[model samples]
Target chain A: MVVEVRLFASFREGRFKEKELELPEGSSLGDLLAQLEIAQKDAKITIVNGSAVSAEHKLSDHDVIAIFPPIAGG
Target chain B: MAGYAGTFLRINLSTGQIDKESLDLELAAKFIGGRGLASYFLTQEVDPDVEPLDPANKLIVATGPLTGSRAPTGGRYMVVTKSPLSGTIASSNSGGFWGAELKRAGYDFIIIEGKSDKPCYIHINDDTVEIRDAGKYWGKLVGETTDLLLEDTGDPKARVLTIGPAGEKLSLLAAIMNDKYRAAGRSGVGAVMGSKNLKAIVARGTGKLKPAREDECKSVVKNALKKIRENDVTSKGLPTYGTSVLVNVINESGIYPTNNFQESYFPTADKTSGETLAEKYLVRNVACFACPIACGRYSKVGEVEGEGPEYETIWSYGASCGVDDLEAIIKANNWCNEYGLDTISAGATIACAMELCQKGLVDPDEIDGPALEFGSGEAIVEWTRKMGESEGFGAKLALGSARLAEQYGAPELSMSVKKLELPAYDVRGIQGHGLQSATSNRGGCHVRGYLIAPEIIGLPEKLDPLSLEGKAVWVKIFQDLTAVIDSLGLCLFTSFALGADDYRDMFNAIAGQDLTTESLLQAGDRIWNLERMFNLNAGVGPEQDKLPRRLLAEPISSGPCKGHVHRLPELLPEYYKERGWDEKGLPTEEKLAQLEIA
Candidate 1:
């Protein structure tokens, strides 16, 4: 199955903005982070299929994942 | 007030009388300083019922103990007055060297009251304070005015605060530009200044601020620098991307507040994100006095160069209007600074007009000279120019989003609270921020509390952005702490890594007090209630403490936050309970007594 990944802010630096990767049938969000070379601490929040979930949460086929660093502005 | 400059300057513009008074130690101890002290002074000096731009209104330029000291990110000050836009108490803070210079010029604060019959500017060179003729500089833009003032004062190192055509025209979105680009930008403080016929404040101070325990304060400052360096967001992310770093994070969180908040998502958000700006337009990163985190951007877009398009500034002009052009946003941002208008209010007002035009509630021709439609960068720039001049179509736009939306008979479409325009964050994704907006004394402001950090960024602790639980308690905690930080004349960003205890220690070392973190928080509460009371006396009630109807009724139709509305009703009750307020959300007698507000 293929899952789409999106990177924002500093995470996008020296990396791709959007990438699609093929993965195993039941890969957790952590596996995708490891695959993308994104450290767990560096990823503040992981949004999978539009809902924020923990790293242990399983990623389904064709899931859209977004990783962001701790960022806020006003 | 021993740790402070130990004096405040009072200028009665009506009589052209300037008096320097010793800082009241009792008042300083009670209100702390800066925002808190300014609020107390505003309520005492100016009646709430008076017109905001009237001669009777008072503007308090306030500093804090940390100001001008060797404290990290301590070069800050706030202007407090009744808002011309919101008709409520407003406290707008700014950073840069001007605030620190004011402190060093032998003043903890400056009170400007009454009105001047002729254009004037205040010059302070150490103990020398002069209200000089500003007739030549009156009509100039902020940049030129600053340059002329610095030249005329014969102090190249002087820090000048000035307003441009927007403020001179009494436009509701006017901001007071300090140190060229930094501003006490919101709540129309510049309009108040313009009404007084004051154009600039130039300060050139040679005196140094002496902390009570110099060694202890230095130690605290070093520790603060260490904490800031260790924090990824402050040290790396902010310095690298400027404030625009949040562009992608907020958009990804599904709460970017695009297109006058009609949608929570903007497909072209990436086109104007921080990553894109840094790559294409960034000239360099800059910092204010004594600041380690240089989040300020010195950028250019095809020779139109200036300081920012800060996170909210860009978001206000970019996704909020669906204008994906980075150069357009950069131009719009620069225009706002040069002309002295609050970008958030100006852009948000433009977005509101575009929506009104789109809805057929108002015609495009009524806007005068442009399509006034979303996604048009040219329209954004043109209308911004008009708003600055307060001529033709810009006159109505200058009234701000609330009045403009209401003028079209669609008051509910304003996307504001208490008549102040909301910032870039759509409250549908963060209930705590919504609560903050609803209860903000100065209206739909983000800085009063900035509950977004915990909800979206998770500074001290993370909370589910969607959850309505414990938000009231958390909001109160953040709000109180923010008050303390603002009073300290420190950047709110430092709160991301520093704790209340850290602030307490630094303040104690400087102020010659041993107050605990708990007492510091208690002072914040007193300040909060005092501001609320001022608004209450002005006839603002529980009815005013609410999100817009769209926020309460319309769930986000798309994006990650698809099925969410503000849900403020569910949260306000618990928040009131936590605040020790009645069901009406007014501070109770017991609570006020506990905080010694009276």
Candidate 2:
């Protein structure tokens, strides 16, 4: 399965803005995060398919994954 | 020798007497100035049982060592008093020229006491302080009052802090407005000032602040500012969009708190978002004195052109009330600024009444012929004006959400803590925020321990917003850190870019003192406990550290966190344990002894 990932803020500054990620069917969110070239320690990932999702959660096909550097605005 | 004015001006409004007293270094060493110092004064001087609006109440306007310095975002002050709304210690911090001017005027703080026999204003120029008659400006709006004071003082650079009709009427949600728009806008501190018959305070200063080590201080500030500029949020996001960026993000997260929190999110969030405001209404960017980031937005929506609403105010009056009109939000923001009202409390109270009207809990006749329904932008604006002047239906709404709901016999519907209304965040989705709001010293406030840094924004570290584990320790640390920053007159946004080490360096450079992160954090803890002690002595205790039934019992009906409720029970015990407090929420004597407090 393939999923489109979008990055924002500092994450967008690093390299790719959006990418098509090829992953196995029924891959967990952690597996997808590990596949990206981006450092997991640097990026704060949230799956924004209507709601914020955790990394350990499962991802479905076409799930809009939005990743960004840690936000600190009040 | 540096970082402080070394003195404070004491004014007895009743006697029209002004005196200058040397700053107490021992107190400064313990409290570290600003809100901390104000808390010390409030606890030491004001009796716990005295009514907030009574003559016995003291209003302490304080500035910190970092205020007016070159430190990043250090231009802020705190107005501390017993809140008429909550009857607890209320310290509302504001960013503007007033705090910087106060420091330049050769004072670290101004302690005001005793009710005046008539309207008066305090004029402070350098070392000279006087109580002047304010009869001409008594009934004016905050803007008009500030303009008149500036004109009267004949100094265009003079900074003025004043109250409006809302304050004059002793509204529980009245605010002290400065720089025409910036406000210490919560907990009814303005009502306390009005009760003392203080109309305005105009300050003019010609002195310069000298840090103990000018070269080192300048270097520290430069480095901190550079780091702040490098940060994405402080440098780009906030400067470009102000705080309105949170609207879309929180809305997307399904924690926008729409319609008095009955709904988790607003469908029309885009219409009331920061991006829309910046694209549509933004005219220019403004900054407080000595501030580099310029996060303040000046906007023009129709005829209104001034300071636009931040994310909280936009959410409070826009999505929370079910009003999605951007122009209406701008107009309401202007009105609140002019009227010197806390927009969050004002909007929350109105939303509560509107909900009551919808459920037939409140009669339409009582609302003065307007159907107080959700999304009524017209009614919101109209009633805000009324509330500002304490007229018609506005009179009732000025009492604040908890009081308004209690009056209608549906206090459970009010989303508030200690009578002060909640801000933009919905606790059902943000459980740490729920605990923070419930345990905030003032009331339902986000600033006290903004756990959103870790939970929502993922700053420093990522934590699950839905999880209850380890939040107690984080909340305690954040609370202590916030207390230090707030007391030091530094903007909390600086924490996004800089840590306690940077703050300690700045402190050492400015104050000529050797300080460590641990020591500074201890100061924050001391201030926090002192505030809690004040509230505890003021009759607010474990019973008050509770959410409304709506938040505690009713799960969010729809959206991402649908059927989810705040897990306060799961978290409160841990929070208590971390704070060294008893199950009843009382700070134990052992903890006090450890902190060296008698």
Candidate 3:
């Protein structure tokens, strides 16, 4: 299965605004993170469409994933 | 005194008498510091029935223990006074080096009472305090006054808070500008300063604020800074774009309040977004006294290079007024900062006038021949200067939105609560935000509650923004947590990444007292109730805790949430119940007892 990922702000600076990645039928969030070419390991991730899921939770096809960096402004 | 200066300076401007009082440990333990301490002093000293602009009214400047320390974002202070705008208790917080400097000057707070016979500035050099004549700086802009004070004091690092011509003219929406751009900018605190004939306050302190247990506190501070640097939002998004980054994100979510809440989104939002500002105007990044994030941006709007407007300023001046010209918005921001005015209130007031003009309720002659049309960048800049200087149309605008609408025989059209104008967020689309705004102690304000964390940004947790269900509970929790953070003098922005437990940890480390999460929240609840009590005693009640008729009756004409109206009536009951208040919005005796306020 393939899923779409969206990144914002500095993450976009790294040309990671959108990505198409292949995954197993039921790959966990941890598995997807391990497979992605994201340079930073401490990046915060948010699933924009799906429920708040942990790294161990499995993902489905067509799930929109949104990732962010730390918050700074008030 | 692990985290205190051990003294409070009291200045009676009328007699030009200054005295120092020792900090009371019992009050410190009960009220904490900053907003909490300021409220305590206001309640204890100032009479509730006195006019906010009268000599009897008092202005309190307070600093928390964590302020001026190595704590991340510790450079914060609050100005508490009887607000001329709302005629109720008002506490306006500011982020700058001034707060930290006060703490370093061997004083936890400074309380000014009795109007001065003439214009003067308070000068405090560690262990020494005097009220000096400020005749030269009487009508100067905020930036100019700050420069003159620093030069006269011969201390480049001297922290200053000064009012501009707006305050000198006693404009109802005047504010005190500190550290150049950071402001205690709500509810006419600057007017109170003006009433006291205070033009500025300059302080220079060489004393260090060392913690009792330096090693432990240093470790805690280091870890917190490291955590902030690692946080994705603080490390990259905020530092890179500042708060203007929210423009695109909010606009994308279809909750950007445009054209005086007539619409939920702005079409030209991208033109005024952080990305656009970074590409065009951004010159450098600035930070408050000890802030490590450096989220403050200094930008060049045309030839002027200074502190740029933040997210709220952009929305209030740009999108809210239907103008998308970033440079014009920047210019308006500069005018407000220089003139010592609250940008949120000033912009909102102008937006209200523009809406009146669109409805044919206000004549062009009333606005000095300008059409006062939405999206007119030139008009915004022009009227803003007029308002700051209290000239012509600006004189009417200086009366604020509520008064302007009332004068036009359309008070309901004013998008304000208790006379104070609303902030950037449109409550029509964000339900919880509406509840918070309506119930704010100082009238329509976002800082009092800020339900946007869950409803819009989805920080810590996510919730449906359109839903009214559970909104009452959400608003209560956010309000309590925010009260705790504000009283402790911690930057409320940290709540974006840190939770209640994280705050509790820091509070315990700084005060050298063990504080459980429950106790901390209770402290916040106590502070909230105390503020409410002050307001209620000052004559604001259930009638004041309501949104304008337009928000409750009129639906959005277009957008994703088109035809949506605020459910304030339906939510009010639940909100009161959650807050342990009655229908009159008074804290129940039982609730007060639980918080130990009784």
Query: Can you give the lDDT of residue B112 in candidate 3?
Result: 94
Q: Give the poorly placed runs of model 2, Cα more than 4 Å off.
A: A1-45, A50-58, A61-72
TM-score for each model: 0.99, 0.94, 0.92
Error of model 2, residue B376, in angstroms: 1.4
Give me the candidate number with maximum TM-score: 1
Evaluate candidate 3 and give its CAPRI docking class based on DockQ: acceptable
Tens digits of lDDT, candidate 3, B112-230: 99988889999999988999999999999888899999999998988998999999899999998898899899999988999889999898888887775677787777777777777
User: lDDT value for candidate 2?
Assistant: 0.86
TM of chain B vs. native, candidate 2: 0.99
What is the CA-based DockQ of model 2? 0.32
In the range B253-291, model 2's lDDT, one tens digit per residue, is 778899889998798887887767877899998888777
Instruction: Give the CA lDDT, 0 to 100, for residue B330 in model 2.
Output: 88
lDDT of 1 by residue, A1-74 (tens): 89999988777778888999899989999998898788888888778866777889999888889898766555
lDDT of 1: 0.88
Candidate models: Cα lDDT each: 0.88, 0.86, 0.83
Cα RMSD for predicted model 2:
3.1
